[model samples]
Target: MQTLVLVAHPHLADSTTQQFFKASLPSTGVTYRALTAQETYDAAREQAALRQADRIIFQFPLYWYAAPASLAQWEAAVLTRTFVYGDHRYPLADKELGVVVTTGMPAQAFRRGGTENVTIDALMAPLAALAHRAHMTWLPTLAVHQFNYLDEAQKLQLVVDYQRYLTQPAPDTLANRQAWFADRLPAMVAQLAPADRATGELIVTTMTQQQDDLEALMATLAMIKEQDDD
Candidate 1:
């Protein structure tokens, strides 16, 4: 899908998390617009870009529980009634809206009874509401928390997952996830030595079998529940 990423980080150059994350995005089928504090907001250009994209992503570092002022200004200038909700039709209707937010605090802290005292979902309600108002499908938010603390391996894994989030063709579902692993296992296993390849294959086979068994069990339970309802 054609994706447009509106980056709203005020200091994106200095932010390690955002820099790494931005670099991880796919090189094709994606466009990046970095909002700058000193730059003028071009509503016409922004609207045209949005029109061309199948997926619109607002990416920012969480500032005072929200996006930066630049983004807010962009929204105010671009999301006009005539453009977004004219008598003709909603321009963004049926498009997908997504959010990618980076937090300085730990992920665990952004939960009920935690230090932040609110879930990331709760924190991102405004963006969700924006999608609803614009008649767009709201994709799950990608929240990167405490990125400064992650080691090299963890950071690598995060980037890999982030790339998948941005580029994955299918929605987040168990079947799709299983298929992703199945598709990657062979290439991953090929890197292993001859003796280790057998072990890697066995692991993949076991995991696939377990997934199948779990799916079957869930189906049986669903059937039982349907009968009970009847």
Candidate 2:
């Protein structure tokens, strides 16, 4: 998938969480744009990037219950009516729009009677509305709450989770997960150091067996369903 990550952070250089995410990005099939780093807005270029991306991610730290001002400005400048819907082209139709928002507080803080007194989803209503209007698929927001407090294991797990979020297909089913890893297994194994290459190959073989077993079970289930229908 062609993923576009638009980052809006006023002090990106100082943000450890943001830096970590940047380092964790997949090496291919993704484009990164820092909104604040740009000298000026280019509506046509921005729109072109959006059109080319199969999945677009708006990455930013929450500010006053919303994204940073640059994101809002970028939205205003690029999401013109003629481009989105005025001419009824719907260039973004069926594409996915996701958010990767980092919050200072814990997940629980963004709930009724909690510290923030509002859900993350509630704060992101405007962006969701935009996706709806454009007929694009609205992905569930990926919120990183209190990144500084996460343990090393959690951070390591986030690397894989975040990568999958960008490239893995929607519905997040087991079969899809298997297929995704399966597709990448060869390249992943090839990149392993010689000492570890054997282990990587073994993992690929094991996963392949598991996938075949899962497919066989699914086929049996489908046959049972058909029999019941008859």
In terms of lDDT, the best-performing candidate is: 2
Candidate 2 TM-score, true structure as reference:
0.90
lDDT of 2 by residue, 57-90 (tens): 9999999999999898898889999989877889
Candidate 2 accuracy as lDDT: 0.92
Off by over 4 Å in 2: 215-230
Q: Estimate the TM-score for candidate 1.
A: 0.79
Residues 22-49 of candidate 1: C-alpha lDDT, one tens digit per residue: 7888767889889887777678988999
For residue 180, model 2's alpha carbon misses the true position, in angstroms, by 2.1
On TM-score, the candidate that comes out on top is: 2
As for model 1, its CA RMSD to the true structure in angstroms is: 3.9
